[model samples]
Target: MYRMYDVVIVGGGPSGATLARLIDQSKSVLIIEKTDEKSISKLCGGLIAPDAQRMLGKFGLFLPKKVLVDPQMFYVESYDLETKNKQRYQRFYLNINRKDFDNWLLKLVDRNVSISRNTKYLSHEYSGDSITIQIEKNGKRDFVESKILVGADGSQSQVRRKTFNDFRYITKYISIQSEIVGGVILPCYEVYFDRGLTDFYGWTIPKNGTNIIGIALQGKDAREKYERYLKNVLGNNFQEVSRRSTVIIRPRRLNDHKTDKDNRVFLIGEAAGFISPSSAEGLSYAFRSAEALAASINSGKNTGKDYRKRSLRIKFNLFMKNIKSIFMYTKFLRNLIFKLGIRKL
Candidate 1:
């Protein structure tokens, strides 16, 4: 007899792990993760914003010392590369090693929730009340049945793409990051905005003894622009430790913040387009969406309807973020704000 799980989550990151941790214990759950234990590195700046910190506190969780990195930042230095204007803003962000942070979250998941490491989610088909998913592992294909399928995957989520054929609702960017070991660490996080380089932005974050420089680019010559910025910033005196790249998403419309489809499939975190357009922060959204979905499941209600209702606040927040992005991304407004030292510390 074939066994069926109550829920099967793709991508064992923050959203998947948090859902597994919070879902009803009686319900059988399985998480499919592509990355193995030996090599776990997420392409992220690894900064925990105040919103994420509050969400952690609500979960009664505390960041272990081992997960934290050096140079805890209390300010952000913003620069408009085109205008050559700079300003400092007061903000507190806890720096952390993203891999360690993910590992920590995974460790907190309930033992009853099965985690399949190095497994990739290929596709899924709905039949009757359950969905049959095809997963790949070590050159082998296997099928699993679940009453509900959750796509906690990242921006390039297969589940999301297969479910929602429309891609025009959200904007996507390629984020490239490099860690330099010998660069001088800045006292605070540095943000750069240059329309020539990227419509999004670039940042330099200090972690441990290394400086992490990353940029989000949408069009051609992304690597070239990133390298030029790297050379201009580091001045040929730094050793390149490692380079990482991944897809990042920003919701273009309120409709883009989708939580469910057909009352059987669901999405959370960046997969659902809950990331902040202004700041690109998704940790808080990941945690909150997971909680909302878990609540929906544990309520024993129509999970899809409940999740959609619970996610309205998140969508509203994203809407506000989009409005804020207008101010941040508009060159004239940004330059004026910087020149006037508005909110500067």
Candidate 2:
């Protein structure tokens, strides 16, 4: 006979780890993580914005110096490649090593919460009152039973794909990032807008001694566009250290944010389309959604209904972000803002 856990969370990212940390200690919880500590480098810009800081404060968490990277940014330098327009906007961001940050969060989880590292969640089946999950680790397959299943996976969430299959209407972009060792370090974050390359945008963020050149694009020519931008920016002078790619979701409408299915299974973080459409920032959303879901579960009431109610504020926030994306992405409106020098420091 298999022991049934109170909760089984797939994907041990920020949302999953946070949920494990915040959920009722009496409940038996298991977290399935695909990557180990050494191989947990996620494809993210690693910039912690003010919203994420606020979430950390709420959790009574403090950042250690080991997680921070060098050359902290204080502002953003916006550029229009097509029009040659430039503007500097003040924005505070905490530069961090994403892998370290994620590992730190994982460490905060209670030792009682079983974390299966280097484990892959294959599928799940629901019976009368419990859900059975199939997972693989090091060529060995095993099964686990749970009263509740949570998909904290990510944009390409296996749990969400197997369960809800919702949020397909939300737009997805391919984000390509290349880390270069040799480049001129800028004091501010560099943002580039060129409609010819991509409908989204490109950016250059300076790390300790390296610089990350990244761009968001769609269609078959994504790599080609990213290569073009790399050539334009680095100009064959910098040594490319590494290249990473991932899918970024942009939720445009209110209906795109779906958090629960059937009161037993739930979604959180980017798996539930909680990312910002305008800024592509999801850390704060991840933290908030995980907290809300934990609260809903701990309440021991209608989990799904409570989760939906708790998520209304997040939905409203993303809705406002969608409205901002219009002014930020629309060519005419963006140019108008640039021309008028709105909010430029």
Candidate 3:
């Protein structure tokens, strides 16, 4: 007989973990994570925006001293390659190690919530009113039945592939990041705008005592473009200590969360393509979407309807982001905006 669970969430990242924490303890929740351990480094800039902090605060989560680096005032520095103009602004944001942050979130889950590390969700099938998921661990396979199935896997979500099978639902972009140790310390984070690089942007974020630099783009020669931009910035002093790559999901549908009503399958986080189109910041969306999902399940409402209603603000903001991206990428226009002594971006 297959083990039964009230809710089975695939992927134990922020969205899955947050969802598990928000769900009532009366419900049996199982989080299956492919990683063998909780201390895996995710390819991210590790910058936590104020909105994400606010959401975490609602859940009584504060960045522990061990997990948070020294509180350094954030500064936004943008360089315009077209006119060789630089603009800087004072901003506020916190940085934390993603590996540490994720582990901390996992620990916050209700003790009753079952967590299975090193387990992979192979596939799923719907029968009657329940869903049966095929999972693997240690060269062995098992099946778990759940009333509701949630997919929080990631950009290349297997759950998404199995359910939607639609390639155009969400657009994917390639992102590469490198951690540079023993580099020149900067008091503020920096962003570079170069048409020669990615269509989006490149960033340099200071975390702890090291610098993390990355570029995200939709082009085939993303790495080649990144290298050219790096050469322009470092002038030969660039030395990467470690490198990682990941895909960023850009969901075409900002208003509706993907759900299979008959199959009881739901998607949140990157699996649902909940990510910022401009900044590529996902922590806020992950937490918000998970909260919405939890609320929908708890209220026993139409999950898709609740999710869409709850995400209204996010959808509007994303549309604005799309508008901002247009002017932000233009050479002369961006330089003019920066020269106007306005660095709010």
Candidate 4:
């Protein structure tokens, strides 16, 4: 007989774990993760906003003391115009070690969640009402039937690759994040702004003497732009300790869930393009999506639109649009000032 579950979640990241924790105890849920007992290594600059904190708190998720408020936020300077004496502004934000925050999120998951590690999904055969999955574990293969499947995998999502064409969207983020043990001494979370980092931002978040300095470039030639920003932030004498590059994806439509076909499998978090297009922040969106997924499942609404309405997708959709529009304005105002000679050329 085929093994069965009400829901089967792939990936044990924040999105998946959060989703599992929120599912009603009455529902039998199973999770498949490829990593070991300790979880896999992740590269990120973990920072949570007020709303994100509140959402996590509601679910009993809390960070360590080290995740304290070091920098509320900061903005270094934006390339408002092509001028010698360009004025730049600063904004402050809190930063935390990526590993610690990730671990904390995993800990908060309710014990009842049956999270299986060192397991992999070979393939899936989808029928009208349910799906059949070929799962691998400890050199053994098993077949499981699940009514609902959630894909919380990151950018390179297998679920997305096999299941949906609609998840495709404009690639807007190109970022380089690094941890430098020795760099120019900076205490605040400073973000340097420029046309390259337009829409996205650059940040120097404190990691206890070491710094997480990087740029989120959304324009053409982002690699060179990102490199230049890294040099400027770290200074010539600075030595590299760590580095990573990432491409961020955003869903096409911001808030309208009218397009969701549902079809048994749900794409949550990065799989669903929940990352804020402007900030490239998705942790909160992931958990919120999980919550929405939970509510939608409880209500017995099986389509994507109903899921979207249940998920915080609508609220976040508005937030994403507003932020994107604001950044566009910032770009526009700067360009207009230079064109009108209001600022130096």
Query: In model 1, what is the error at residue 194, expressed in angstroms?
Result: 0.9
Task: Output the better candidate (3/4) by lDDT.
Answer: 3
lDDT of 3 by residue, 140-169 (tens): 999999999999997777888888876465
TM-score, each model? 0.96, 0.96, 0.93, 0.80
Candidate 2 segments whose C-alpha is farther than 4 A from its true place: none
TM-score for candidate 4? 0.80
Q: Model 1 clash pairs?
A: none
Q: Rank the candidates by lDDT, best first.
A: 2, 1, 3, 4
Q: Give the local distance difference test score of model 4.
A: 0.67
For TM-score, the strongest prediction is 2
TM-score of model 2 (CA atoms): 0.96
- Scored by lDDT, model 2 comes in at 0.89
lDDT of 2 by residue, 1-345 (tens): 676899999988999999999999999999999999999499989899889999999999999999999888899988888888878888889999999999999999999999999999999988879998999999899999999999999888889889866646778899999888876648668988988998788889988878888999999988888888887766777899889899888777777788888788899999998998888999999999999999999999999999999999999988888888888888888888988989731
- Give the deviation of candidate 4 from the true structure as CA RMSD: 4.6
* Over 4 Å off, model 1: 183-185
Q: List clash counts for every candidate, in order.
A: 0, 0, 0, 13
What value does the lDDT take at residue 342 in candidate 3? 74
Give me the displacement of residue 70 in model 2, in angstroms: 0.3
Q: What is the lDDT of every predicted structure here?
A: 0.89, 0.89, 0.79, 0.67
